[model samples]
Target: MWSDHAPLTIQLTSPLHKPKTMTWRLHENLLSNPQVAQDIQQALTNYFAENLPQDTSPLLTWEAHKCVIRGILISHSSALKKAQEHTIRELTAKIGTLTQAHKRTLDDTLLRELTAAREELARVLRQS
Candidate 1:
């Protein structure tokens, strides 16, 4: 029998509500397995260093569906170039990790997505 006078203390928590950044890293960490979060973080940092523009905030807000690369290139201030490069590298590394995991039997849909994403990154870099 359920006690009517019992103190109802309920502690509620849900796993799905974790922040996107944490979740993003979580997926990668799980795939990579046993590596510390800092290792993943460092890998992402290195990837950014190699492929992205010096400034990438503009790219984040830039609409791929509506915006043309040429216009974006012309509009971005020189200061943002580094950020853009960094973003491209980071994004590429993250996507590439997933794409490479399957290797010989790569998922067609995922490959297309990564290819499109890389092209977008290149376009942003190519912008004059």
Candidate 2:
């Protein structure tokens, strides 16, 4: 039972056996914008601090960071979209009002021109 050609029974399961993982940290620039930075920090502290898994594996950490970034982008995009929509509505209303005024003025001018032409034709007919 103790053959010289037998394989080793030990199995590797330590961190050393695994490949070096990418470790990431928040950059200093995250603090550059005071207001946004504060919001990010607060959210990070509350969510990342409290909600992250205890494992902290490289893949999980990377995914968590991506989720946070995605959330921030979504929030910013939503706010920007609202502002754009509001500006569009205001411009559309102003344009409509101007167009209506132009149409009315144009109608009045056409009416005056037609009336003058009719008067000229009546005088010509009476002279003949």
Model 2 scores a TM of: 0.44
TM-score of every model? Answer: 0.33, 0.44
Best by TM-score: 2
Model 2: residues >4 Å from true position, as ranges? 1-35, 51-53, 102-128
Model 1, span 31-127: residue lDDT tens: 3433333444555566556545555554653443123332323333323556777877887886677577647577887788778777786786675
lDDT of 2 at 122: 53
Model 1 misplaced regions, further than 4 Å:
1-78
In lDDT terms, which candidate is top?
2
Residue pairs in steric clash, candidate 2? none
